[model samples]
Target: MDIRTLQEELVQYSKTIGIDKIGFASASPFIELKERLVRQQELGYQSGFEEPDLDKRTNPELVLPQAKSIIAIALAYPSKLKDAPRSTRSERRGIFCRASWGQDYHDVLRDRLRKLEAFLQERVPTCKVKSMVDTGELSDRAVAERAGIGWSGKNCAIITPEFGSYVYLGEMITDLPFIPDKPIEDNCGTCTKCIDACPTGALIQGGQLDSNKCIAFITQTKGFIADQYREKIGNRLYGCDTCQLVCPENKGKDFHFHEEMEPDPEVVKPVLKPLLSMSNREFKERFGSISGSWRGKKPIQRNAIIALAHYKDQSAIDELKKVLIEDPRPVMRGTAAWAIGKIDGESSQEILLNAKNKEKDQDVLNEIEKGLQLITR
Candidate 1:
């Protein structure tokens, strides 16, 4: 059983099957990552979406007993949207981050992992294997860094020399003692572009992120967006690309290797007003295929309302007013009330006042009051 030969064969097979990059890593406990995660947890910097158990997240052996090596894979996604529809005042649009541009990368990466698993099982009939994508307990970036797939960038993304930071990452843990690849050298030297470009200053210094302030995290929350960050979120409906978009390492790095990763301009940057009133069925039928729709329509619609306000598109006033008056969700109704005031339309004051009188939710009433204040101010 020549593990080195097997590793080489796996690497070659990965490339043949559309994996942009693959590297082997020792499946030892991630010591540094555990410490960092502990600090992040202590500071309340972690996004609640992560697997909560620290030991489970850091120790590979817990996930797969006798885990000896890990295989990390990267699949490049298109950063640039080709032939994107223009956003005009009459038809304002909100942008979904490049990550959610195409078919959910989770599905795309999971399919690749399944293929790799099949290939490995056929070669090593008795060896055990386990795989995970972003949703898994293991940190994909940590595995990728250890596997030499890429260096960890200041934006907290695994930056490959060939694909920049615009790559989806996944890993497979197995009881195969494949030689580990050398970790890549960090290339972010004194470059504060990503940190500076962060609209909400989510990137605290370099590599550290306060998820509470991250627009990417904020866009996923199914509740009222804090007033301070609402304006900063701008037209982002899901996730934020400011950090990656500003990185020098990512310059001229755009890959369209996978057809499934291509962005449909209309879906990724849909008209803002239409999204405000979309039924669940309509929203799913249009956006269910994309990763951004995982949080459902509430957050997207809330951000859409904020986007309309960002544009100060008075034309959306009628739709926003309807949401404020008729929407069942308090978050939707409240956000609409806030957006209406932010827009400061000719009839915004009157509409907000009427909603204020009839609104039962305390939160909605407070938002109505804020809207009234915005109009008078």
Candidate 2:
């Protein structure tokens, strides 16, 4: 196979697909991935599936019976106007992560990759092509590093000089053989900013992440968090950006813009009042198209009450009381009870006591008591 000739065509194809960077590498198997997977399993970070042998994902012999090259591409999620704090709920704001601030990259990348693969197959009818995004068993970042796209940061993110670590990575595993680019040296230095700013210690060690300890995981958790972590969740109802914010490599980068992911002007500051009164139908209508909408409304609704509690807003008392009494979800009731305790003074205690006395649900009573403790203490 004329590998160099194909590389040239493929690189240009990637650019035409809107990818900012592209590189090629030999299809060798990963050796370190095993240890990492073992560690993730031990740390209880495995996504409910045991790691199958790494070979199935990284080894060309297994990935594509004749796989000889891996093509990696990066899309810059640059921000244009992100330096400002999230605007108030009444004002238009762009609080999305640099990556998600625009149209869904998954849709963009998958469509483009399919197009590129089709272009290749039209010329080489027998060639095989498979494309994925953080998908399957392959080490996406490892492939990018070996392909000479960029060096890996200590935070476990791949970083390019022009785009920092805010790029989404995807790959095309093909049957054509290509000369692989050499890997780059690490440029993370001694920076510990990402580690220090991680509110939940997601970054436990070099290139190691305990996703369970990850705020992103917590906020997106499918089930209820243990009550212990609830108090620490703060006002954040969706995703957490603390670690990314503190990364030096991300400094001075442009703010990525996209109209779809722009923070809803009505919820930019993520206030508690509008949230407290939202019915399930209203919650669906408001956040239906956004990323956080997938988990449904319980987590955000629970988080709303937590924020109201921390803010100690007396104005939120009546609305919170309504949720505490009317919301079917016990989790929301618990959090709303806490918010009422924080906002209401002496009389609020009486309300909670009355609810506790009348409430038949053990969970609701427990939530009421938790709120009582918050105020009493």
Candidate 3:
């Protein structure tokens, strides 16, 4: 079969299989991305979740020796939740960002890539293919942008005019030389809304992020979040969508294309108090399937405490106190202490004092001291 004809067939087949967009790009070194990545490293802007090897990351040849073309795919995910649960004064809720709304995107995208690979293998028996989703060394955004799936927006997301930025990207490197698609024009001209709206100023400049200041990255960390960012984190349990939310392109762009991408309101926006005491089994049973739960329960629970504090929900004090005293993780206990301080300051004085007396962990003790100070002040 002709490579271009096969590419056309693959594009059509992709739509039948739930791929919202598909494009092809030359499997060449990402020269500009390499320099930008080097700059990001020198400035310490990386989130540390990316593949560390720059050589393999920028050069398709390094990832797949015989790579001739790269096929990029995008699957549109739901940006809006139906029947969304509200965070009441009594039952304060913490939110998982839209990116983690339904099923773990890693699993969903991988499934699509697997199907694409299978389709290619069936058509061209000798075709060599290497496929990857977000976790892969290759930058999904870079490949997607090059393939005309979207233009890389100032918010550092691939912004498709069709789906807005509400899409999951994946790619497959193949030996077949498919005709590459023309790159998309930059549609985010003069738009600084995403940059201006970042609560913590994590969007340092257009298309560059200081991951250290990013709430999305912070929420996934195991350690206690720094004092400065804790307040800015607001009610987010996992990830931050401030950049996307502020983008004009994402306005009124909600697609419920895939059933698995549909969000369960209660799961994505759960009551903050119960999360404080949720057992590992309970957390896994409740939230294990979602992408937000990948860092496990500690971060979520910690963020829940912070969210409760952000609301100053006195109703959650008892739960916060319980977490401060009994949670085995120092980060959790410490964060709970801070939340208690923020919530019931004067009223939580005794609780903070008592925890300070018995807490052996220096970090937890420090947090307990901060709690006491909050009460006294």
Candidate 4:
């Protein structure tokens, strides 16, 4: 078979493997991105994107030993809105961004890519094909842009006409040669909605994110959030979608028809009351297969309490009280106290004082005092 016919077959195989968008590009070094990786690693921002190694990510050779061509595929996570009054102005958003609203994108994307790789291996017994989703050092986004899958928008995401940036990216690095598509240029001239919409100023310059200030980064980091950043985090429970939501490219476009990207019902703007009530085992059991389960319950619960406090939702007081008293994680108790103070207000004065008296952990007690202070103020 000709290379075009062989590549065409892989595309068909990718559809069977559950990929929503598949595009092809030959392997080429990305010199500009490699230089930027140095700064990204030095700043401690990559985080869960990769293990803490500057070299492993900067060098594509680490991903595929004899890499010659790359096939970049995109899987769109449905950005469907449930039938309700969501996306409202008084937003205490407890939901994830559409990218992560469903099954773990990494899991879903990787499985499909692996299937494609296996099929390629079966067809060409001597050729080498490696499937990866961010595990490899290859530039997934750059390769995607080159593949005609999408252009890299000002948001630094590969934006395609089909799904915007809601699609998950995965790749197959292989030895076989194939015709590569020409890359499209940036179409975001004079548009700054995504940059302007970043609440924490993470999007400082076009296509740049200061992960230190990013709420998505802040939520997952293993330390206390700095005092100045609390109010800016708003009510985002998991990840913030302000940038994507405000993009003109995403405007008036509906993703409701796409079932592959549909978010699971359990996490779609989940009530804070239910989230705080979960025991660790229950959390693991409930979210094990979902995208939110990757960090375990503590991170999500901590963010939930923060959101409740920020929103001043009185309905969360009961759950917050229980968390303050019984959560094994001190971080949870401290965040709960802070949230309770913000939520219960004058009505929860007694609960606040009792919690203050009962709180033994120093950090948690300090937060209790802060909660009390918020009440007094």
User: Taking the tens digit of each residue's C-alpha lDDT, what string does model 4 give over 118-203?
Assistant: 78778888888777776566667878987888888877778888777777788887888878877777778899988887878888
Q: How close is candidate 1 to the true structure, as a TM-score?
A: 0.99
Point out where model 1 deviates above 4 Å.
none
Q: What is the TM-score of each candidate against the true structure?
A: 0.99, 0.85, 0.98, 0.89
| Residue-level lDDT tens digits of model 1 in 1-377 | 58878888888899888999999899999999999999999999988999999998999999999999999999999989899999997999999999998999999999999999999889999989999999998999999999999999889899999999999999999998989999999999898999888888889978999999999999999989899999899899999999999899899999999999998999999999999889999999999999999999999999999999999999999999999999999999999999999899899999998998898999999999888889854
Q: Please report, in order, the local distance difference test score of every candidate based on alpha carbons.
A: 0.93, 0.69, 0.91, 0.74
Q: Ten-residue segment with the worst summed lDDT in candidate 4?
A: 84-93
Task: Identify the leading candidate in terms of TM-score.
Answer: 1
Better of 2 and 4 by lDDT: 4
lDDT of model number 1: 0.93
- What is candidate 3's TM-score against the reference? 0.98
Off by over 4 Å in 3: none
Number of the candidate with higher lDDT, 1 or 3: 1
Name the lDDT of candidate 2.
0.69
